[model samples]
Target: MAQKNIVVIGAGFAGVYATKKLARKLKHNNDVTITLIDKHSYFTYMTELHEIAANRVAEDAIQYDLHRLFGRRKNVNLVTDTVTTIDRDQHLVKTKHGAYPYDYVILGIGSEPNDFGTPGVKEHGFTLGSWESAIQLKQHITDVVRRGAVEHDPKKRQALLSIVVVGSGFTGTETIGELRDWRDQLAKENKLDPEEIKFSLMEMAPTIMNMLDRSDAAKAEKYMQKRGIAVMKNTGVVGVHEDHVDLKDGSTFPTATLIWTAGVKASDQAAQFGLTQGRGGRIAVNAQMQSQDDDQIYVVGDVSYFAGNSDRGEPQIVQGAEASAQTALSNIIKQINGQAADVAYKASYSGFMVSLGSRYGVANLMGIFHLSGFFAMLMKHLVNMLYFVQIFSGYYLFQYVMHEFFRTQNDRNLMRGHLSRQGNVLWAVPSRIFLGAMWLVDCAYKVSGKESWFVDKLRLPFSWLQPAATSGASAAGADTTSAATGAAASGAADTATTAAKSVFSLSYQYGKDPMMVFDQMPHWMYSITKVLIPNQQVAFFMQKSMTIIEILIGLALVAGLFTWVSGGVSVMFTLIFCLSGMFYWVNIWMIPMAIAVMNGSGRAFGLDKWVVPYLQKVFGKWWYGQPQSLYGQDTVK
Candidate 1:
């Protein structure tokens, strides 16, 4: 069998998914080689570029290493080089490094911002296209805010604080939404009046998010307006200068920043390929996503223009890119297997979700269901989690949740665009001291108790170890021990017997000893806990180790050493105690506090402020001992 070269160009949403699918589909075929080529060494979550630009997320949060993405795929070879041209006649792709021939090619190179020949827009307007661009924009925003803080002249200060976003589409809306929150925080931190910060989202169309239903668009606009973002409808930017944007209405708004999210067009390579170019310079493709001129070459993502079966053309969104990639990959596989390329692209538009800052969002589901407020925010998170699950491991999803959602203070500080030198000192010190004191007190209580506090308190939750007597005699014995009168004793005995039998019988049957623990917990919880720690010896070891762990957690928190690890461990222990029915109310409180401490709470006051750096120097950036700043300096201790 001759080895067939299958080359995937670009590492965007469509390209990455197509490569992964190809790798899975052809893993068993020894006669096929899959090569993924991208100019960048990492894949950026382009959808989250707004978060990056707003400084709401760490740059690392949106980037996943390309090598790590394909580390487990034996047949996939990643090439980090720019694609210069494609020779359809010779079945080869030319790169800056070299030329490579391929049996099948998939292009998902994505698109770049279209300036539309607007004067000064290309040179002055910042874009949210790539990681570098997003970072640069973030820096520019930070610089403007910093400059605004000291500028005495109101006019100059206003110009420094104002931002004009050209377009009210998803990217533009999200960008301005994040900026709204960021600007407010910046104003507060700089001691400037928040009213001075100006935000404008301009759209040439009558409404924002025109692709969405009118109701959803209206909801988004209302949310934006409520957040103080000026939604300038039926407005277009004729020109963008260094310090002002010239609107088509002959109005000039003084702004230091102009974000160009108006539109994107296919990469220049699309036009250079000599293929049939369609609208927006995108390569024209058939229903199967194959090039109009060459069946062997398939184009997907924003770079592909498909005049589909419907009146509307395919959208240049992630969903459309994924759908096109699937269709193209399927056709390529079919052709490889000596079958007809018949599969057509079928877009699955589940819904659209737009986040209005941190906690607010609006979403339209399947053009039928509409949601707003926390539910919409939750849906947006779930969608992002789904994407994370697809590209990375469950651990990555956990990290994403921890970094993006759980740690609010840290995220806010990040969004504010600067890490103060004394930032950690302000919050981490008090939190660490308090959390450490609580842990130490808990350890003392556990150790001072007579009898193995571990067995009496923690182990008592599992009825499987010590079965309770359900006999009526046991209940009668309890009544007699109470020393009641004859008639009262009889009545009390009956009541005690009924209650004892009810609780004991259930516990024995279901392995739940709620009598000594939290009686409020559901029966299923006991069943789960019992199944997880069924072994007596294992349970005993865990019970004994908890006290020691508590002591160590106290010491670590007090010393401000390995605060995140200790705090996470503390959270785990607290959860275990709650599940085992130890201290329900106390554990609940401890859980949240423990989470707070996990965000590098000890960095400012505890030894971690200096210890972390020293350890990083000694250990050379080992995952566990990195500097506290690695987790975000503004993170709670």
Candidate 2:
């Protein structure tokens, strides 16, 4: 039998996951082949584009490899090429690379930024639609500042630093938040005054974050203003010139950078393929994830017009992309198995997580309750990490962890091609060598059972206690000549060894205190750690441990750095993090770190499994910093 070829287009979140699920579902059948076509081999996370554009993160900070998502699926083949035309009549698709003849076609090709026909918008404005666009925006923003710093005229300098972001949707609002952060960092880095930088977010609608609830929208607007962004409601760009944006109200603002994220329209490719388009030129697909007019065709993600509501009762959102993909994969499996392909997909907004720069944001899970402040920020980061784990199979997450821990500022952006500056390649070679060394060390620590090499090489005093104690015991043994002294020595040795073993064991022991073990602790207590300790006792323990650890680590890393020069730089870098930020000084940062370590790496699919060996190799030698690259170095700094 000729094999059934399932061709999927686009490599966005929907297209990437759709191919994976379909391949898995049809893997048992030898008569099925799953081929995914994308313009790029890797999946670029559209959500984190703002972070890249603002320079808080590298371009690859949010990207995941599609091949990693496929795992060991022999049936899945990834082809990187631009699709020029799709001929449904002949069951064929022509791409710049080659032509694909498919038994079934799934068009998950995502949308492009909507210019809304504003003058000079296409030529002047930067759109955060793809990884490339985001990178370009970041570079352009940096160039603007670099040029402006040398300019003598104050107004011209301000104009050069001025950035106008159109639209107030998730992308628009988030981009503004990042822009504020990047601007702040740039101001500080370049010694330019904050007043010289202008970040304006203009929306035609009555409020920003329009998709969010009214209260959330209000909170977001307030938060944005507090972060130095001017949120203009019921205002929009009527025209965009090379150096300025004319507002709808006829007010004009001088600016060098204009970002058009006002709206999104379906890809012309989708319309050319003849899929029924909705209001935004989005392809309309049936409940089964297949095109309404053709079962062999599937359309998922942002391009798909799924039935849903956004305050007003209307169909929108790409959340249905995942739902549609699942259904399409299920249908494809059933079709290959000679069974009924009738799985219906019902789209529902499960949750919404948004990152508002480094500090604050809003979320309404299932549009039921609103979350903001630290909780929302945590949720947003988790959402990003989860997506990383999902698509890249945690490779980039591990890369993130390694970079966070060991890589220097110069080293962080070395492999990131999108973050290149017009500098000599000389700095990059050493950076690559350093990363390569870290990776090799990580691999060795994994392959070999050398879990403590990092600690040993770094010679952390906490770890050195073992050798110090052994030396003390040896000294005591040498002096013990009497029977009574020998007996006392033996007893002390046994007690000390038992205590050390208990403290060294990373796994939580179930035996606990005999008193608690005898209590036959309630089943709920196992899930809830708080119940195990009374609130008062919890407070007491935290108060005591918090100060002691903070002081000791602070003094040792900070004060001790002034004494020693070998690990001084790394220690100072780590210590500066502690004293520099008020957030780090608070309980918020430590509490989460403690909880994550205790919970054992998000239960499953975390990079912990990969990080364990990597950390073991560099454990003592270098501090394992947070898993984000270079503390937003690519942006302004």
Candidate 3:
């Protein structure tokens, strides 16, 4: 008796789990052999990538060994290689290294970042679409920060700190928010000035997080703004230079760090497989999670677009990828058993969660839940833990906890010696170089009052608002209106003009509002107040009370301690003690949380870990001491 062969492409969440389920279901029969083919041996847990870049969590924490993941499966064989082509007629698949015959094939190769014809983006910017990219970004960030520490010039330092994340979509917006926080922590840990750090998230679209409801998008914008992240809406990167990004609005943002997450497109590999692909090059898959034209082949994740009323009929997210894999797995098992089992892959994400560093985050579930402070931070940690537990089971859970506990101890040793050397441009000579040439060209334009060849090629438009000094009021007077009733007309015109300006200003303000932390404070307070106050609605009364209580208790504790120790309370000394204590435990924790819920726990993964270690390796004795020494030179005593 011969065995049936089933080959599944991609080792992502869908492919890996699908393989496991299929193998388990067909194990008893011993009549089916499941072959899992992927470009990588291991499946990447992509959700925690922001933490990796920030160095809050280690790479190995989220990434699982493929063999380890499927060690118990007797009927499954994992093949590590890229699948180059798929032949439907012959039921064969060609790989980069070899070829395999398949009774049924599953395509779940996943997705890649869309450059969208932006010049120099692929050559310059980094996108967080993959583990390798995350690692690269982490290394680059570490190098940039270290270099910033040693840089002599202020302008160059600012540029090194200037991190512009393109695309205000979920991945772009969330990733940039995390980067902002990581920079802040890195700055504090390294004794770098907060003023020197610059982070921006730009989008060409009218708004960000477009998939969310309008209100949520508005809230997200406000949150981004509160953290001082420059939200350049209705603006996009048109060109990427070595040190600057040319925007669609004819402006250039000088930055050394450019992270592109603006858009996503399907892999070119889909076309090679001869699957029917639509907009964004995503393969069109049918109800069984199989390719429409080829029943044996299945496509999952962002690489394949599946239609569904679930999730509001939008495109699939990370959750959808997992769902697709599960469905494909069941169908594969049914086909192997010659059972009439057909299931349509349906995915509806419960909600979305975005973590802003360790303490701050946002979750949109049943209703808009704006999480911050300890609870929100806790949620972020729990989410990370849940992801690991869900994917690899309890095996990595204990290790993750233990690794976090010992992380700070190891971090202390690593935080000392080395200065960051990442993405540090030594000179602004390029700016000056371009500026000088532009000035010369401007001079020529002034002298000749004519368009240059390059200008003509660019099809650049001239400024209609150019000052009257050049064209004079004679050129503008034609647009002026004459008034019949001077006083009344003036008043009416003024009123109308004022109203128009107000409307325009309001719209502009709304558009300019950046996504950041603390924007949800009012809403959160309002919700709490609705429950707390009986007679009148009070905003933030609880937080205010907590702060006051913390202060008073701190004072009482100080007084009591002094009475016990020396039998007398020194008023000035007692006040100082109380204030310092409040600042340390309550104020420090409360304010940042109230603004954004982030904690310095398992959330950090990449640059922070590498930079801290690299610093300790280089600085040795001069390195900053353990986490306790961060507040002051001495311990609590």
Candidate 4:
């Protein structure tokens, strides 16, 4: 068989997704090689670009390293170069560095800001079309604010502080929302009142969020108005300048920062690719996502115009992009296997979610349920996570959580800084020690426990572990008093006597002393234990093993070594006990303590500080390929 070269262009949502799927599906096939080419090395989370533009998150928060993404795939090659043109006649993709031949090509070059021939937009307006553009917008705002702070002239200061966003779609609405929330904090830092800065959303349409239901749009508009943003409807920008924007209604807004998020069209570069172009300069693709003019070439994302067995063409949204990519990739894989390229894309849109800043949002779910405010924001985050899981690993998911909730500054994210208010892990040292001490105390009593545990104690068993010496003890339906007396009488049983009741028992009486025998245990819960512990020998072995594990867990916690391992064990044991009808009402704090400590709490004044790094450097990969930097840097290749 001849070698097959599958080339994926652009690293946007659809491009990266198609590349990842193709690589994974063809990983074992030595004859196929997947090349993912992009101008940028990292994939940007386009939905969250507003965060960067509004300075809500760090500039790099929305990026995923492309190298790390394909690290484990031997059949994949990542090319970081500008794709200048595609020679469809020769089946070649020409980049700045070189030209490569391809057996199959998936074109998902994404979109560019459509100035709609509006004069001065490209020259004077800021855009959120790409990561560079977002960073540029943020920097420009920072510079303008810095100048505005010191400017004494009232008109000049107002102009310098004014920010006008022209558009009311997802990008424009979200950009304004984030700016509205962040403006106050930014103004105070620059020694100006937030009111001195003006924020506006100019929409040429009668209302904003035209794609959303009218009611949902109204809800979003209400939220914007409440946030102190001026909503100007039936407004059109005729021209944008360095410090002012001229409107069609003979109105003008003097502003140094004019962000254009009104519209976008397919990348103009595609027009030169010699593909059959359609509406918006998007390549015309069939229902199978293959180019109408060329069956070997497929188009996806915003650059592909496909009606796809529907009345309207697929809207240029994230869902449409990914769905189209799936169809394109599927057809290519089929054709590669000598099968008909017949997989057709049927547009199935669930709904849309638009965040009104990080704290609030509105969503129309399943084309049925309409949600607004906090729940809507939560839904949006969940949807983002679910989508991320498809293309990335848990490594990115954890990063997403950290960026959106725990690491976000000034309560600018959905969690509103509740999770962000983290203190030194060293402060948890005392609590860690306390938890370890409780486990040790529990293990002490179990090691000297009667009958079963005595068999394994040093191979001869502790004398204190023996049953009480009372004559009537066996017939008295178990007397804990006699057991204690016998334990105290043995001088070596001091450790056992000190902890008469296990710390886990917490003195909760379930119609009797729960520690003695776990009386009134649930039948269903103990069914498995009963079968496994049928004989005295197995029971004794289990008892001894449990005792050793508990002791080891305790020591590890106290010394702060492998806390994730020990803490995980502690939680499992605690859950086992609780499930076994062991009432631990008073000592239930151990569960949460164990869970909390698992988050690298051992790094503080403990061996884990040294051990974890060594493990990550040497034996770092999770059986899957992600680096084992749980709470450290993502040093992915």
> Each model's TM-score, in the order given?
0.76, 0.65, 0.61, 0.84
Best by TM-score: 4
Residue 457 miss distance in model 1 (angstroms):
18
Candidate 2 vs candidate 4: the TM-score winner is 4
Off by over 4 Å in 4: 307-312, 441-519, 581-584, 596-600, 607-637
Regions of candidate 3 where Cα sits further than 4 Å from its true position: 152-154, 188-191, 308-314, 366-392, 399-637
- Relative to the true structure, candidate 2 reaches a TM of 0.65
Error of 3 at 462 (Å): 99
Better of 3 and 4 by lDDT: 4
Query: For residue 444, what is the lDDT in candidate 1?
Result: 78
Lowest summed lDDT window (length 10), candidate 3: 594-603
Better of 1 and 4 by TM-score: 4
Q: Give per-residue CA lDDT, model 2, range 1-637, as digits (tens).
A: 6788888888887787777667656668788887787776577777778878887665676666554555456788767677887777888888875788898887888878888788888888889888899989998998898888888987777778888889888788888886786665688777888777888888888867767788888888888888778888889788887778888888988898999988887777776776677767777666776776777888787777755433221233446567677778778777777888888876666787666765677888877778997688766666656655554355566665433222313322223223223234333233223322332343354222444332322211111122333331122222224587675766577556544543322234475311111111122322243333324445345444433443443332222211122123323433433332211222223233322222222112333335555655575234322222111112123
- Cα lDDT tens digits for candidate 3, 1-637: 3678888888776676677667666778687777887777677877667767767667766676566666566787767777888877788888877778898887877777889888998888888878888989988887777777778887777777788889877678768777776765678765788757788888888877777666657766787788888888898789997678898889898888899987778767777877788668888877787787878787777777765553322364767777777778778777666786487776656666665544455566645565444455456556657655555445456655544433422131112212111212223223222322332343344222344332212211111222222111112111224454563464456445434533322122453422112111232333433345322113234334433443443342222221111112223323332332211222122222211211211113212335545654566334322222111111144
lDDT, candidates in the order shown: 0.76, 0.62, 0.60, 0.81
**Clash tally for model 4:** 0
lDDT of 2: 0.62
Best by lDDT: 4
Please give, for residues 1-637, the per-residue lDDT of candidate 4 as tens digits: 6899998998898998898888889888899998888877788999899999999888989988776677677888778777888887788989877888899999999988888999998899988988899999989998999899999998888899999999998999999999888898888889888888889999998878998999999999998898789999999999998889999989888999999999888998898788888878889989899989888889999999986554346788989899999999999889889999999997878899999898999999989999998999999999888877888556678888888887777888777777773546887788788888888887676665463355643331211223343211112222224676663354234335434644445556565433423323334544555566554566567778887888899999999999989989988998777655443456677888898887677889889999989887565354324422221121244
